[model samples]
Target: MPDDKTALVISAHSADFVWRGGGAIALHRAMGYAVTVVCLSYGERGESAKLWKQDGMTLEKVKTARRTEAENAAAELGVTDIRFFDVGDYPLDLGPDTRDRMVDVIREVQPRWMMTHSKWDPYNTDHMNTMRFTLDCRMVAQAWGHNPGQKVLGAPQLYLFEPHQTEQMGWTPDVFLDITEVWDRKWAAIQCMQGQEHLWSYYRNVAENRANHLRRNSGGQAGGRAAKYAEGFQTVFPRTVDALE
Candidate 1:
């Protein structure tokens, strides 16, 4: 681990982090890790239907609403730092300065591990594009020759959180995290996303379902640990261990 135990999460939209990795953020924060979340965009254009449906809704107003919700959610999850790029969505393009800024964050945090969306998403190009840009920035941050004086990053495993529709997104989870203790915190964070009210109970159901999987995979024998709520993740890089349990 670095001098400071840190972890980074890159989200395509303002609320993506909460819906996808809120449990992980809370669980890790409770474990003495500083979790930093970077929201690439507010998702105002594409994902803010509820806000847009209201009368006399402007872009700035929607953005403000989205930012407020994310900030509250981040607090609920005990996030150490939360940054917003304020980049427009619905084809979320990385502005010229955005990539360098992201590199700066990666260098600053020096996270031991990172999290983001899956490699592909049929329904949302923004999700996949964000993943691509995150990986690209990570590669740049890891190269000592690129920035010279700036701190270069070490090898950090990137965990892809569950997509909205995992079956259609080709996401297969290999890691199941038991977030039973922090489930309440995650639920509070999920509630912060009032813009996406429809997904509240949906994600709760997902946690319950993943807990079942966690229970079965944790050697479903007599007296196995019971996980009441869990979150699943897919590791992008193969982990190296000295010995098997």
Candidate 2:
């Protein structure tokens, strides 16, 4: 574990951080990385069965509940800095304005690595927009493009997390992290969703399936992969991870 590693996870919605990359977040925290999560929205419109079912569930109530859920979930992963950006919920607009906001955040954080969805996804408009924002943010940082009013930031290494539906979306992961050691933490973190039981089960199964693939593909890392889970990621551009001593 690195003593002073900083990680930033930028998610389209609150649950994406938990359901998709929970293990990675948890493992990073456990390994002593300072994990910061940027949740674009509270997921009020697209999904909120649990809170909606409650009597007299207002928008404020849903926002509060989701915020608490995110806090608890991220806490499980030892993450302490949570930026709950009050962006739109589901079916988010990835217009130029949103791109500007993303660029500003990138400039402020100046993170070494940024993870978002692959630009190839089709079903989820929000996912596609997220990729656009990430790419645009990079271009703005590198001064390859203009993001008026946003300070310039250095280009960061970029990564694309695996899409939940790999086949339908045609996601191909070139890198997979053996998160076997952190699977339980991932599961526990996801339980905070509290809004969807069936959805949680589906994600859990996905994690298991990814683990199976890891065992077969880990090669030398295969020794510790049995009965473990993993996460896959796709990269858009070449990355240079500086070796720090």
How does each model score on TM-score?
A: 0.97, 0.85
Off by over 4 Å in 1: 1-4
Candidate 1 weakest ten by summed lDDT: 216-225
RMSD of 2: 3.8
Query: Which candidate number maximizes lDDT?
Result: 1
Q: Can you list the residue pairs that collide in candidate 2?
A: none
Model 1 clash pairs? Answer: none
Per-residue CA lDDT of candidate 2, range 32-124, in tens?
A: 777778888888877677778889889988888888988998888778888887687667766777767766666666666678776666767
Provide the clashing-pair count of each candidate structure: 0, 0
For model 1, residues 8-122, the per-residue Cα lDDT tens digits are 9999999999988999999999989988899999999999999999999999999999999999999999985999998789988786588999999999999989999999998
lDDT, model 1: 0.93
State the lDDT at 211 in candidate 2.
78
Please identify model 2 stretches exceeding 4 Å from their true place: 1-4, 144-152, 220-227, 239-245
